[model samples]
Target: EDKLSQEEKQSRANHLMEVQEQISYDLNQEKIGKTFKVLIDKKEGGHFVGRTEFDSVEVDNEVLIDASKFYCRVGDFVQVKISEATEFDLYGEVV
Candidate 1:
C-alpha cells in the first residue's frame, strides 16, 4: 500500500471541500420558488441578511424585482420566497 504525500492529502482535502460546497449549492437550488420564514439577523450592503430553519442558509433580503414594497428590521420574521441562489447564499422577496 502506498501512502499519499502531505501535499497530495491537502490537495485531496481541498478538492473534497470544493465538491461538498458544490453539492450544498446544488441542494440549495431546490429552495428556489419556495417560501420560508426567515429571521433577520443583520443588514449588509443595504440589504437585510438572515437565515431560515432550513440548513441555516443565508437569505438575502434584497430582491432584484420590486424590492421597494417591503420593509423589515433586525429581529423580525418575514416570509420570503426564494428567488435566486448562489454558491452560498439565497436571495428572496417578502411575501
Candidate 2:
C-alpha cells in the first residue's frame, strides 16, 4: 500500500474549497442585479457598510455602498440595487 504525500493532501483540500466556493456562488447568482432593502450600519474606511435581511446583524454577509452616492446615516433603511456578488459580500448602489 502507498501513503498519500503532504502535497497531495493539501492539493485535494484546495480543490475541495474551490468546488464549494463555486457552488455557493451559483446559489447566490440570483441575487445579482436585484434591489434589496438594507439597513445602514456604519461607515468603514470610505464606504458605508450595511447588510440585508438575508444577512445576520453581526456575523454574516455585508453590502458595500459608495459613500458619495447618497446621504445616509447609521440605522437608516435604504433601498439598494445589487450590482455584484462574491462568496461573502455584495456591492450595490443607492436605488
Candidate 3:
C-alpha cells in the first residue's frame, strides 16, 4: 500500500469536502420548482457557492455544490431539482 503524508492526506480530505459541498448545493438547487439557471460564483477555502436567475442577493436561495465530478462547468444548462414553492437547481448525473 502507498503511504500518504499528513499534508497529502489533508489535501485529499479538503478535496473531498469540496466535492460534498458541491453535491449538496446541486441537490438543493434541484428543489427549485421553476426552471432557473445559475453561475458558479467562486470557491473559497473548500466551499463552492453560486447564484441562480431566480435567487436574489439575500432573499432568494442560491446553489451550493460539492463539485465532485468534472463533467459540470460554470455555464452548463442542467436540469435542476424541483419543489413546490422554493427555487432550486441541479445537474443530474448522466447514467
RMSD of each: 4.0, 2.9, 12.9
List the candidate 2 regions with Cα displacement exceeding 4 Å.
1-16
Taking the tens digit of each residue's C-alpha lDDT, what string does model 3 give over 1-95? 76999899999999997887777566665565554456555654433445666566555455555556423455554444333222233332211
- Worst 10-residue stretch by lDDT in candidate 2? 21-30
Q: Which parts of model 3 are misplaced by more than 4 Å?
A: 1-35, 71-95
In model 2, pairs of residues that clash are none
Whichever of 1 and 3 has more lDDT, that candidate is 1
* Per-model TM-score on C-alpha atoms: 0.79, 0.74, 0.36
Each model's lDDT comes to 0.73, 0.86, 0.52
Per-residue lDDT over 50-89 for candidate 1, one digit per residue giving the tens place of the 0 to 100 score: 7885544433223222235567788888888988987777
| lDDT for position 7 in model 1 | 96
lDDT of 2 at 95: 86
